[model samples]
Target: MTPLEILSTTATGLGAGLALIIAIGAQNAFVLRQGLRGEHVGLVVLVCMLSDIVLIAAGIFGIGEVVQAVPAVVVVIRLAGAAFLLSYAALATKRAFRPGALNASAQQGSLNRKVVLATVLTLTWLNPHVYLDTVLLLGTLANQHGDLRWWFGAGAAMGSVIWFSALGFGAKLLRPVFAKPGAWRVLDGLIAVVMVVLGVKMALGI
Candidate 1:
């Protein structure tokens, strides 16, 4: 590929990944919450970006095809991921409705790095859509160039890194917005709607 073509391909890859991630979801919510609170910003961003890289790389390396071929396994994952998504959505909605401290970062509890890590890990790995995007969609598209597959993968990984870093840090600028009580409600509610819709779509094969 020419330099210009390479740039174009990488840009396209970045756009594709960003399209999937820009919407409100568990990952975004967690990252935004951390950014707004100025807590564990680096940890949250690193986990999210690394998780995407690993998942996307695995997808490009034929692992995704193997997993997709196993219908039984895929179906099980679809169901389990659906359950997790819905549960998260429910929790978010409840939080949105309840009267609580606005600054969750100030809550009386450990940051729970393990809990946060596990949540993103599960959401990244278990969700069938994640596999479909990284493995089936992006992988197939990347394979079109045969020897240049790695370039496509590189583009996607770059996108992931850029996105997580931005979402984590960029959200900090919105601290005043998120700090307002109404902002949390709006944010959490939007996330809840996104999660529940995504969960049902996966469960119902939409």
Candidate 2:
């Protein structure tokens, strides 16, 4: 591909990636929470970006075809993700009912690093939508660029990195607002609603 073609392909990939990820979902919710709490925010961002890169690469390598071939894989992932989301929603609901202190240090100490990392991985990897966006959709779009597919994937990966970094770091600006217990309660309530709604939708295949 010529330089101009490459740039155009990469830009398309970037826009597509941003469009896919910049939505209200479990992954973004968790990242936002971590950012607001100032706990392992960098780690969360890194995991999300890396996971996207791997999935995007797999798509560029034609794993999307395999995924499309096995419909059961998507179903299983959807069910698992749905269960996780529902459980998390329950937890969020409980938190909303009795939100404890909103101090970052107070809550941050309760979450262990390993647990945070595991949660990040689960949120990123277990969602069927992630596969749809990064693997199936983006992969198919990248292939339209022919030999420039890898470049497209690279651009998508860059988009993921930019988004996660911005989300994880930018949420800190809300620290002052979230410092109040009421703010945390409201946030948790919203999270619970989002989680439950998404979970139900996934379970029903709607």
Candidate 3:
């Protein structure tokens, strides 16, 4: 591909990837919460970025087609993801109702690093929509670029890195607001709602 063609394809991939990822969902909520809490923000962002890269690469390599051909696998993932989201939603609701002191500087009652890492991983990998959006949709779109598909994938990966980094790090600016316990309650409540809605949608395969 010529230089102009490469730039065009890459920019198209970047925009497409960002459009799908910028939607409000369980994963983004979790990342935002973690960023607000100032707890393992780097790890959370890294996991999300890496996960997106891997998924986008898989799509470029045609694994998306294999996944689509297996309806049973998708069903299993959907049910499991729904269950996990609902369970997390319950926890978020409990937190909303019984919020602890939320001092950003104090970092009081921070969750363990391992727990945070696992939760982020589950949120990223377990969601069926992630597969559909990153693998199937983006993959199909990238393939349409033919010889420039890898460049498209690279651009998508770059978008993931940019977005997650901004979200995870830029959240610090809102630390003063979230310092209030009431803010924590509201944030957790919203998270719970998002999680519940996503879980229900996944469960119903909607």
RMSD per candidate (Å) reads 2.5, 1.4, 1.6
For TM-score, candidate 1 versus 3, the one ahead is: 3
Q: Model 3 Cα displacement at 147 (Å)? A: 0.8
| TM-score to native of every candidate shown | 0.85, 0.95, 0.95
Alpha-carbon lDDT of model 1: 0.76
Cα-based lDDT for every prediction: 0.76, 0.88, 0.88
- Model 3 misses residue 151 by how many Å? 0.8
Q: Write the per-residue lDDT of candidate 3 for residues 1-206, one digit (tens) a residue.
A: 69999999999989998999989988889888888878899999999999999999999889899888997888989999999999999998887775352433444446999999999999999899888889999999999999999999988998999999999988989988887657877787898999999999999999
For model 1, what is the error of residue 133's alpha carbon versus the real structure, in angstroms, after optimal superposition?
A: 0.8
The 10 consecutive residues of candidate 1 with the worst lDDT sum are: 101-110
True-structure lDDT of candidate 3? 0.88
Residue pairs with colliding backbones in model 3 are none
Q: Roughly what TM-score does model 1 have, to 2 decimal places?
A: 0.85
lDDT at 86 for candidate 1?
93
